[model samples]
Target: MQDSESLQIARAMRRIPRWWLIPVVVLVVLAGLGAAYWAGTSTTAGTESTPPLAAVVPVSATVERRAVVKQVVLSGKVVAGAESVLQASHAEGVDRLVVTAVAKEAGSHVAPGDLLAVVSGRPLLILPAGVPLYRDITQGEAGPDVESLQTVLTSWGYACPVTGSFDLPTQQALGFWYKAAGFKAPTASDPISQGEAGSAAPKPSSSDIMFRWREFVQVPGDTGKVASIAGSGAILADDGVVARIRVADDAIVARADVVQAEQFAVGMRVTVRAGSTALDTTVAKVSSFLEGEHSENTIPGKDITVALPPGAQGFAAGQSVTVTAGSAATESLAVPLIAIRQEGGRPYLLVQANDQKNDQANGQPRRLEVKITAQADGWAAIADVDGLLVGDEVTLQ
Candidate 1:
């Protein structure tokens, strides 16, 4: 009875689901094959594919012959080259004098012996430079000052000899000058007082001569323009300035500031520009002193002066301008700044060849050694180079 029961149990177990076990076994086999195929494909793709090498960068520029000028640009203003002040002393001991008439206005041109103004109802004439007028010049006076007076008198069509002595001819010339200027003729018997002689004792004059020498205002030299003038109703005091004259036409100059004073020197050429006008000039002076008041935060700099050429005209004082101080030009083969490369303290330039196959196969760029002589305006002048010519294409990188 026990054997029969065990046999029945084994048959029941065998008949329970043989087809379901077959499908489970096939599913496990298919999963193992799929995983192996995926692993093989991934390994093949990783082994076959590799990153490409870096491609050649391309840049090109034309080589040419040009002028390279190194220049320093600065902002500046127009000013007078030379100036002189006309004071009340030009009209003698006439302090607190009223301006009766204005012969020339500001911006008017003037020459020697021109009427600048009328002070105290008398003409103030502009004359050439001579001895300062301390007192009235008489016939007995004789010196180099008298010689200067005779020279000027002769220039004005008067017949006088320049003997450095106030002789008869000088006195006659003084008379002619007085008559021409509408003044009283000098008399030989005029008293020579102690005050006029700058002495304590008074003396009598032997000659009849008395010239109003203090009535004239002598200019320094050359022609000038009236920069400023007092109105007709203004009162002039002792040593007070009546007008200001400047040498503007032929002696115009420019003032500018620079960070480096050693880079500039006197007699260096410069170009000055005002609006649309431009003029060539030269540096006349340079000062390194800091003048006047300034804030503590301000940076110190040097001042430079440039004299304008005579051809530059119609420029007004205080006009805004720009100046460019340049070095000597260097004529040579030049290229753009980007085309140059520096390596190991040496400069070089890459040149692009016309043949592409060789460049692609070799992967080596051609370079030329160069010495930069001058650089300006985004270009560099190069020298001491071989195998390079004008119009050749150069690579930047």
Candidate 2:
């Protein structure tokens, strides 16, 4: 009977379909995978290290007094300013100006009464700042030029009176000046001194000297350094320029694009740099830029001129430099541009109310209306308004 039952069980197992067994096997594997997933999720929930997200906080800045400055750096060059040219003037009975000797060369500093050159065997001296020589000043002539000469002579300790008349004392002063310059003074034309029609050369009177306008040239200013002088043998006509003078020091000239030049104005302060040296100066001038066709060799731009301040040094013409120029507003309350908000086309700021106990600003930001004086370089210069004070914190919204 046992054998018969075993055979019946075997038949029953074989009668089961293979597709049904496959379903059972799949169910068991899925159950195992679900259990593993549940265990892993529980473990991760208990030991996870990530913290919860915190509340969002707004950024803040401080309101303080400062200047809103806009600056532009440009390539520049040191150049010489306008200069005065020394020209030869016409003399009485003289047809040409012949340079015989040049006592002062280029780069020589000259002052009044200094000998500069010898022209046509006559010493050419430097006169004080005045009008140009127009005519010969005789011994008895009275004029404004004679008075100026007398004043200069008196200043040099010659003890001459400024009477505007070329008198004996003036003549004596001229003689002394000529003697000091290593030249003989010419005397007035006295026929009595011409002994018997050229029996001997006429002897100049001891107390009389005539002022010849050709012997001196008026320097344009008090003093100047000679830039260039004519050659010793160069011949020139009247009104011909003999030498050039640099009356002032070097200036810095910078070129800016037409669009960038609109911000540059005269009297603006600027910083000039060359190599490692920096100088502070003011803008002396600004040249206008006209919109037109430019030649290939010309650069289309506006020129910015900056003059060296008094006592400036270590600068030379033709040197390359960097110029920094721009505009600046006076000291006023300012804040970052991000801190400023606009509403209805009006500028406003969000300021945090201070906690009096700890001086900490932890309260809600309050909206404060402000007037923007100027804005530049990510900063807005503002005028003080109601409830706006320096040292107050502002929200960057």
lDDT of 1 by residue, 189-307 (tens): 53321121133443333255555554567667747888898889888866667788876443333333444555568898877888888888788878665553365333356667777
Error of 1 at 77 (Å): 3.7
Clashing pairs in 1: 187-208, 187-209, 188-207, 188-208, 188-209, 189-208
Please write out the lDDT profile of model 2 over residues 280-315, one tens digit for every residue. Answer: 788888888844346633367888888975346767
Candidate with top TM-score is: 2
Query: What is the Å distance of residue 113 in model 2 from its true position?
Result: 1.5
Question: Could you tell me the lDDT of residue 38 within candidate 2?
Answer: 100
Each model's lDDT comes to 0.71, 0.78
Q: State the TM-score for model 1.
A: 0.56
C-alpha lDDT of residue 184 in model 1: 39
Please give the lDDT score at residue 202 for candidate 1: 30
Worst 10 residues of 1 by lDDT: 190-199
